[model samples]
Target: MTTVTTRTVTYQADALTMVGHLALPAGSDRRPAVLIGPEGVGLSDVERRRAEALAELGYVALAFDLHGGRYLSDPEEMLARCMPLLADPDRMRGIGHAALDVLRAEPRADLDRVAAIGYGTGGAIALELGRDGVNLRAIGTVNGLTTGRPGEAARIRCPVWAGVGSEDPIMPPAQRQAFTAELQAAGVDWRLAVYGGALHAFHHPPVDHTALPGVGYHPRHAQRAWRDIVGLLAECLPVAE
Candidate 1:
């Protein structure tokens, strides 16, 4: 196993103090960087481990926070906080940019070679960054096919890859069609993968707390989605050994 180091970082956004986790590979040479966003439930061990995994793969990674470092275990609270934030693209951009700044601040981060990947609400933020014309090598989202203003999507220069469960009630076929149509109209390079028999948040591991309906964990699909995400990163933002 490759040696990696991680630390807790705190930054401010939207008048709230956000705590994020940063992970780096063993060496000092600058490497491509990846920004990870957590699901609507907020940043937890899942995202932190992802950052660590990316670091092991030789990319500087940061798992950014949502809800100001608070994890929403309550379904009502998660929806109440995420629904409004998701509805406001500007707000999502604010969160994404703030985390990007943190990632860029790292000495080993190659600003010119960066990618943004998110799950759930975090995924929406990644898409928003692309819409905001952020120069990303690639963008990956899981169960986060939320649509944005078409005009803004035209500004996205990087390739986008999204994955969702076929049975996801939150992002059903119609919603998926609308999202792809927006991307197609904008002429953005994009791809979508639907995992059969998987539900929303399938990438996430089983949780002890209660979750809303239509959300569950699928270990097998989760592994497959991670491989796809890594493949996208490798294709778009290869890290030299």
Candidate 2:
């Protein structure tokens, strides 16, 4: 196994103090970097493990926070915080740019080669970063196909990939169509993967606590989505030896 180092990082986004986890491979040379966004519920061990796994693959990865360092397990609280934030693309871009600043500051990150991938609310932030013309190599999101202003999406310079469950009530067929239409109208290179019989947050594992309705875990689909995300990174931001 490759040697990997992990650390907790704290940074600021406007007035908000954001905390994130950074993972780096055992190498002095700059490598491709990945910015990971957590779900609306906030950052969790799942995202940290994802960063670790990316480090193992030789990429510098940062699992960024959503609500400072708080993880909202209560469904109502999560919605209260996320819904309004989602409605405002500028706020989402601010959060993503702050985390991107931290990731790019890392010694191991290759600033010119970076990707953004996120889950749920985190996914929306990733998309916002791309829409804001952040010059990402690629963008990937799961259960985060939120559409933005068409003019802004035209600024996205990289390919975009998104995954969602067919049964996801939150991102139903209509919403998915709108997302795709926006991307297409903006001329962005994009792809969407729909997993059958999976619900919202299907990529997440079963937690000890209950979540909102229409959200559950689908182990098989989760693994498959991870493979697809890795494939996107490999295609767009391959690490150099």
lDDT of 1: 0.95
TM-score of each: 0.98, 0.98
lDDT of 1 by residue, 1-241 (tens): 9999999999998678999999999999999999999999899999999999999999999999998889999888888999999999999999999999999999999999999999999999999999999999999999999999758989999999999999999999999999999999999999999999999999998884335789889999999999999999999999983
Off by over 4 Å in 2: 208-210
**Pairs clashing within candidate 1:** none
lDDT (C-alpha, whole model) for all candidates: 0.95, 0.94
Candidate 2, residue 75: Cα displacement in angstroms equals: 0.9
Cα lDDT tens digits, model 2, 1-241, are 9999999999987467888999999879999999999888999999999999999999999999989898888888888989999999999999999999999999989999999999999999999999998989999999999999858899999999999999999999999999999999999999999999999999999873235789999999999999999999999999863
The 10 consecutive residues of candidate 2 with the worst lDDT sum are 204-213
Query: Model 1 off-target regions past 4 Å?
Result: 208-210
